[model samples]
Target: MADVDQVRPRQAASPSMTARQRLALGLLLSAGFTLAVDFSILNVALPGIGADVGLPLDGLQWVATAFALCAAGFTLLFGRLADMFGRRRLFLAGMALLGVASAAGGLATSPAALVGARAAQGLATAAVTPAALALLTTSFPEGPHRDRALGLNGALMAAGFTAGAILGGVLTDLLSWRWAFFVNVPVAAAVVAIAPAVLAPDRLGRRPRLDVPGAVTVTAGLLAVVYGLTAAGDTSWGDPRTVAALAAGGVLLAAFWVIESQVAAPLVPVTVLRRPGVRWGNVAGLTAFATETSLVFLLTLYLQKVLGYSPLVAGLSFTVLGAGTVLGGIAGPKVIGRIGGRSAMVAGFAVQAAATLTLVRLGPEPSWTALLLVATFAGGVANLVAIVGFMVTATSGLPDREQGLATGLATMSQQVGITMGIPIMSAVVTARVHGLGGQGPGAVLGGITTAIVVNAAVCAAMAIVAAVFPRREALTQVPPAAPPGT
Candidate 1:
């Protein structure tokens, strides 16, 4: 039986970055920017897309939410592909798909076309995210070298999300909303051209073909889960479609586990989840991500619907959250070192929890300056603390050879949170605001607040799990959430 050990340690001298490793990381970072930016930027253009395509307000939610769903659903499958095929080839192809999809989306004449294109774009994103990360992990040798590369990769992602808002806002304001999608064309082209030279070959062996049946079952199951959550908000709890979807999702997922358990190279190694640090890390990530994603979705609505801010302003408002994330990403290492990952996770959660509960009690009529200030500074802080802390935990204990898979799994979990969180929050908002006439805004705000509160509580729980990490000793020497880029 071929274990992961068949692959030898590949290394570079001096900076310890294999030239290809450096090149791969660079291309991957570039590829990653589009995903981060799309999250904050698209909402800025959502109204424009809706207005042009004639989508109902509720239907517009699908534009953003569906992207997350499709992206999350395909990540694991794609991640496995990168492992079985070639990571570099898959990454570049994924970039090409993204570019094509974005172009189609931008040129769409109808909502259905746009949504279809966006889903394609999401699938492309899923492929790139995992493939790129896995490529980087394999390209870089283990130990401090891998850690540094991972840290930088984390920072770039943090920076990209923040930078995305700034660029998205500027572009949407200066040109048509189409420019947001258009912007990717040049970047994607650049990455596609550069990626091949730097990236490593895929870790492929002439193994049996992937389990198509199992893959399909898992994908359908996940799609159903995403669908159910999205539909649940607009429909009754007993809605037949929703119940059926959820049930199907559960059954299919169970089947997936059975299939994987018997397979040679499983998509998710069951043994992996048994590790305390990895388990808690993922738990923390999901909850924290749900909170943050829900916050952005709700914040965009509040800024646009309630505050009457244009798409540009709403996007600009998000810059603050991005900024905070950057700060936290940069600071996370130090914070973890100082307080320990566990303490940092707990303290960070406390900080975010305080911010969210406060938002709940505050009246809706608050001034723009006040709202912007809170959303910008507090959001940033909460985001940085939560994400970095969670990531540290996620990366803690897996064997070096499996780091790429671990990274892929962690990244996939983050996407899943985004997928699951948005719909849940959106549904909560829709339900709470269902009957409200003049108080519609308040009801929506309350629902959002509830989601945030839930997020804070979940983070607090993650802290408990983080407390027991094996790296508790080193975690103390570092601190979390300083700034992302710097």
Candidate 2:
């Protein structure tokens, strides 16, 4: 095994974060949290939005689908744009757009209006996520400080999703479903207001020309792919719409590959993909997100369909898992410092697999204490650790100039994983239930159990892959971040 230092030289020294830097970090995290929350915030509100707007079920689904498609599709394009233009400039523009879109969503009276707003919000998110992450990576030189910052960012982002789930229910019940969208307005406003004061301005020089053909083909390809996967979840892989969309996406992506090869300034530079950390690290990230998200989906079904928990109760139950994620996020940087990112990531996946497997023992009437809480909590912790480690590994050796592209690719992996995983697992659960020849609680339990096992298997397999791959070395440590108020 090689040392991380072999892959990339260490910085001269670890610097303590200034108060302004801390404020900047906070702003970036706030933007990330808002994006994460929006990803799931509308889930519970979907039915309400449909009813109030008199939307048909099919149209209602677009509220979520539009966001997923646009966010996943435009991320890479915007990431490169941030690199070429300016991260801070892109960040501010994204936040402003997000705020406007949120307000539009809240005031929407028609299905088309609402879906359009969601799509705009997704576009803004695609812009903001990579730019904010790039700003963070560039602002904090790689070392313990960078690792710690990334860890905290991962933790908060995960927590934001959980918070959105619970808060969506609360807002829908107490006030209105529109509150879910309205809530982001103030958060975006604050971030946009404070960001310019704290974040360093982007240094402009002779910038490379944009790769228009590569950008267009890749973005269109990603949109089609994500749309197909999203449709697969609602329909089936064999559905004509799914088939056509996926085929079109593949063809477009192939064209993108050819364009990138020939272009003077490719949207995604081939050299970046050649890095062991970038390649294998994204694989780890994709697997980590896919399995963990599928587990959550299965658990939601188990809690609601089998155990008969209310949607609100099921949402609240995962708070334990969210708490564990928070703790793991706090501990992740330290663990990576001790063992290296590769080791920590492998261990995180291994532990997550074991934790997921424990739930295979769950009966129709299982002990929530022994099974649900424990497993979820442990899985949550392991999931965040793996995520943090993956990010650290993926961006480890990249120059500041390329941080936007790296972070964009990293975020894109996550969105693709989340979009792809649920559908695949849903297919598995459906097959298992049908094979059992029943629609009763017993069949549901059996199907859920099978899905859980599959999730564990996937995690274990990825762990083995991460362990066996020798493209990169373990992350090297530096002096820890200075204690607060020091």
Candidate 3:
């Protein structure tokens, strides 16, 4: 593995170049914003989409799952690509592809076509995410500056989720569900224009052989695992398709690991995974995101179905949770800087778990208390706080040269969290919600409560693992401010 500190690039973005640098950062964040918009915006629009596309409930879930599965599968692939080629090149390519795919999704002819387009859109993200993060991490000095940048990046997701929920409802009600994708076109166009001018050009490091076989294996493995979990809600565990996807996923991933261990130019450096901080960060992120994302998924559905909310109201209902995440993401760095990363992570986890517990008391009847929303919102905020801390902690130790790959593995874990969350929670909910005739709302509420409780348990477990976070390093206040090499 490349030594991170040695390879960390110094920022030439200076007094005169501050505007350009900020623009570059903003554009990079736009990529994140676009992703967030897609992620949650679909939650509110699913009903309209299903109606337009003539999809059943299970098929409707696929609309979302397909994007996540493909996105998660390709996360490492793009990460490796950025490492092999150039991070900036891939970033630009990803933007172009994302824009094109977004347009295509808006124009999709059939449900299958839309699903295919969404998957293509997911692939674009696979390219942009790691590369964009690498650029920011390598561009700045590791301190308050970089921390603020990361915080802003985290804030984008919260803001984007808020936008998505509201926009999803507004578009579906006033215009068309396709407007969600259409919205990205103008934003992406603006970014593409400024990116090359503002962002530093990509420079390739060690030209390691691309691990095509390993990439294929891991991709297949992730796809299988995600598919199996997603199908668990609609298909029996005994079903042949479910079994094959899961088994194949397992075999492919195992083979990939074996191949990686033996190969000199492995796609994912084994050493990085062995690093205590990196390993635990991934574990913590995966579990935390899974629980939190599942709550969003299950509750969004229930708000619409059980609570009898329109898409607009359901989306607004999520706004409270989105606001909490934004606040958490924005404030996380300051807290970390004052105390430390570990403390912030653990404290944030506590807040999130407490928020999850708050959701357990939700019922079939509406309450104006706002505690549920506030608690869930706090959980969302805590999520960003913890995850961003995890990112800083995980990547801080790596040398500048390998930041792209490091960012890849780190970001991919979040994708895995979301991918796994939906299916597992759905399956559990469906199983329990059955056999309740005429008490549909009660059944749905029961399922949602169970999922949130499980999510809470996941957060609690994360707190335990966080206790083992390596020696307290004063967390970076802003990742983008870091000197190229920490």
Candidate 4:
């Protein structure tokens, strides 16, 4: 097997770039934003979709789960493929697939068709996301330039979720929920149209090889694990299918590790996992995503179910969150430069923990505009800070050849965090509510508060974990080179 340094190019991007390069950056950012938007857009539109297609509640759950499973399962494989083939090629192809899937989803007449389209869209997203990040990392030198670009990228992606939630509600109310899916078709079409001319193709020194066994086992394992988690939330962890799925997933993952050890060219190189940055960065990423997403999910329910806020009002209330995130994104690079990535990440987690704790004040009847929005804004800022910090720390110092791998790992951590968080926390809420055995609004408030308090404690623990992160220089150190002449 070739060393990473052997496969990577030595030349760095010039600090100054041409107009076309800037356009390429814009397109890449747009692609990432679109991916984020698509994921969240369906959140608010699920009820409408269920009604339209006559989908049972159980089937509707799969609409989101199917997408999450496919995206999480295939992301690493596609990331490696991007490194092997061409980032530009995979990116364009992914965009094309996304567009087609979006159209199919918009035009779906049956439940299976819609769910299948969503799964296809997720697969395409898995392909596009890491490739886009790799492209961005390669396009700029590792310094303030890259930091600034990454910050902006982080901000836009974060903002996309907020925008999607709002847009989904509006589209579902004003027109039809189908428009939520239809919306992506045009943005993707535009990206496909412009990407080829603006973005440069990656050059490979040698033909790439695939670890088919590793890929198959890992993907299947992830799918099974996600399915089990999703099932556990709806049913019980003791359910036969859930137990069987979890057990099979564990065995498959263990088999994957053995396969990876023996493979000449493994899908995920063991060396990658050995890197301090890759390891801790992913841990921090998972914690940040899980805690933040859980808080938002719980708070959204609190606002709508307990407070009886309209969907539009609930969506609009996130303005503080969106604005704070954008501000934090603009400031993230400067903060990281001053305090270092480790410190920034630690601080970010601390802020997030504090914000989540503040939400514990939520009650059956409380003011929505003041205290709730303030906490949301703080959480939003911390989110941007945490995301940018983890991203830079994780991907930094990775050779050109491994950029895809680094980004893939980071993105997968995030996906897994979100997928795991919602189900686990929802189960917590369910159990708490069931234990209270009350059919009143007060019981709902008590349950939500209890669950959120647990979330806060988790965030605090995550912050301490972040505090112990490796130094920036050590985290970003390049791997040792191969012998003089391969």
Listed in order, each prediction's TM-score against the native is: 0.82, 0.95, 0.89, 0.92
* lDDT pick, better of 3 and 4: 4
Better of 1 and 2 by TM-score: 2
Off by over 4 Å in 4: 1-18, 366-368, 469-486
Q: lDDT of each structure? A: 0.68, 0.87, 0.76, 0.83
Error of 4 at 54 (Å): 2.9
Error of 1 at 227 (Å): 1.4
Off by over 4 Å in 3: 1-17, 50-58, 236-238, 435-439, 469-486
In candidate 3 the C-alpha lDDT for residue 178 amounts to: 92
Better TM-score candidate (1, 3): 3
Best by TM-score: 2
Tens-digit lDDT string for candidate 1 (1-486): 211111223234355566666666667767776776776567556777788888878789778767867887777788777766777788889899989988988898888888888888888888888777766666655434554455555655655755666676687677877887888888888998877666644555574467776778778888888777767755755789889988999999999888877887666677776655567667777776777667667677777676667766766666666667766666665665555444566677667666665665545664744755575567556556666656655665555445555766778777777667766777667666764544566666666666656655665565565555534433453468779787
Candidate 3 weakest ten by summed lDDT: 1-10
Better of 1 and 3 by lDDT: 3
User: RMSDs, each prediction?
Assistant: 7.8, 5.8, 5.8, 4.5
Candidate 2, residues 398-462, lDDT tens digits: the string is 88889999999998988888788988899889889999999998999899999999899999988
Error of 2 at 352 (Å): 0.7
- Give model 3 RMSD, 1 decimal: 5.8
Candidate ranking under lDDT, highest first, comes to 2, 4, 3, 1
Q: Model 4, range 182-257, lDDT digits (tens) per residue? A: 9989999999998878998668868668999999999999888888888887788788988998999999999999
Q: Which 10-residue window of candidate 2 scores lowest in summed lDDT?
A: 470-479
**Distance from true location, Cα of 164 in model 2, Å:** 1.5
* Poorest stretch of ten by lDDT in candidate 1: 1-10
